[model samples]
Target: MIRLLACGALATVQDRGRLGALRWGVGTAGAMDTLALAGGNLLVGNPDDAAGIEIQVPPFEIRFEVATTFAVTGADCALMLDGVPILPWTGARARAGAVLRLARRASPQAWGARSYLCVSGGIDVPVVLGSRATQLRGAIGGHQGRSLQAGDELPLGSPDLSPPVAGTGLVPPVVALPLAVDGLPALRVLPAAEYECYRPVSRAAFWGEPWRVTPQSDRYGFRLSGPTLTPLEPLELRSHGIVPGTIQVPHGGQPIVQMCDAQPSGGYPKIGTVIEADLWRLAQAPIGARIRFIETDWDGALAARDALDGWLSAARRALSYLRARSTA
Candidate 1:
């Protein structure tokens, strides 16, 4: 019971994500902002990885082909349901012909990052390697492995209607600690597989200098500019499995953050892996924006991930509590 009344600049389905197919040459493509997507789904009582619409630029208008409940998260797009203002990072309901209008977000244009719209039961699409996430590089997944366009009807299949599950909201915003990003825009680095091959001076400076994100960035990879990092030797290796957080430095001596839709295998040397909890912040960084990385210990990283998991669990419990109260 999902239908598209109108299509905007860029909008498609995503979830907590796709994974475990790197050996088969598939990249995990899902919501760039996992925190936001997770919150939206919990609000509607949907699974964390439920496929949801990712709305990019504004002027997005959708007409519900059927009655359904939904939620929006991430970028604060002035959202509306049948012209009634609704919360972007909150949940709501819709009926057949219900027009959901999304205006430009209130945030600075720099934060034109991806936002999510999760419908209950998720968006029905062919599952590719235990996921419906689209990976255009491998020529598979998603709605034909590309962004959604006009006249293209996305299959929502049939959704079971359920009463709204009231719940506690997601985590409150926090003031990021100083030096939380390592240095003032300095990308952190750890020893890489070929770290020794790089000149000692380059290694010393790599983690100390700041990098600028270039305009030549997309879902496949990010191009960055910084202090030249010429290796002591022309090092090359056999193609190996690549992870989304891997920073690939091509011959140009610039770092590229392999994004969600990056290739599964690569020959480029990786300086380090972006910490799991910080990868989503990459999505909000814009062209010419300075970037810095901070190395975190295993215990610290695990604690951060576990804390988020705890919050998600609390959201579900809130729903159960609300449901019981409503029944009573």
Candidate 2:
């Protein structure tokens, strides 16, 4: 068990998200930076989709009630165990009564806006609708359907093996060593159905200029502040199915990139869809950061996704092999 000594401003329990429920009007609520969640889980030998704490605020504090292995991934939130500084995306064991604290972002170069704290077997939150992730919009699932607070006692899944060595950890290459173009990280996007509705210059500017993430952004969507994109003419449509990464242009002319907690359907005009593999980059980008969008074909998008899947598979296999060797 872990005691929430001091809950941050916006920390919640999350898993791989409640998949296949969009048809039922439930958005897929999950970790913003999924790669970080998977990295933390893999470090501790837990399933990649296992439930963990998704922390957005800093100076978060927790007290371990029992000895167990844990991993911290994503943002370098200046993690310290019992007051000793520890590296992010690293694994370590905590003794009973040990206190773990996370402060503000340590550096500008670090990648991520949110940090994940994954325990060995995962947080023992009751599953709701095929997921332990918090559905904040609907106020369902995850620790009584709310964000964690001070004085809350969160249970841990039963450990089947002893804690791994303190040095065991994995560095996510996606963040530590990012792929860049012209010294700027970019997200690949596929033109959506309404792409042609926009003026030719608007479409050109979308790709040619950089967009800044506004402070109004949250889990629901990122409201971008950039060149005002104007359609060739006013258009209207009925509410239709939409998914995360769908860039919707509202009447205000700003583009909102739908996120994990976005509604299943929307009426806004979608101009493009950020490819699945590059969505993580947008999720981890800090507010006020400028992001460039790169246009890609369907084949290119598929190839990018396949490359990500390959990396995850290789990481899982490597971690599994190390575990077996250690036990042997």
Which model scores highest in TM-score?
Answer: 2
**Which 10 residues in a row give candidate 1 its minimum summed lDDT?**
171-180
TM of each candidate vs. truth: 0.86, 0.96
Model 2: residues with Cα > 4 Å off, grouped in runs: 160-164
Give RMSD (Å) of candidate 1 vs. truth: 3.1
State the local distance difference test value for candidate 2: 0.85
lDDT of 1 by residue, 1-328 (tens): 5556567764666766677766666678887767777777767767656787777666676777777778877766688888778766556778777878777755553243667777767788888788887666665667887777755666674444343553234442121211235434333334457767777787766766677889887666778888888888887789888777788778888878887778778899877777666666676565677887666566776766676677667766876677567777
Best by lDDT: 2
The backbone clash count of each candidate, in order, is 6, 0
Residue-level lDDT tens digits of model 2 in 158-267: 76544455667675756544756566678899999899999999999899988999999988999999999999999798999999899999988889999988898989
Assess each prediction's global lDDT (C-alpha) against the native. Answer: 0.69, 0.85
> In model 2, how large is the Cα lDDT of residue 190?
98
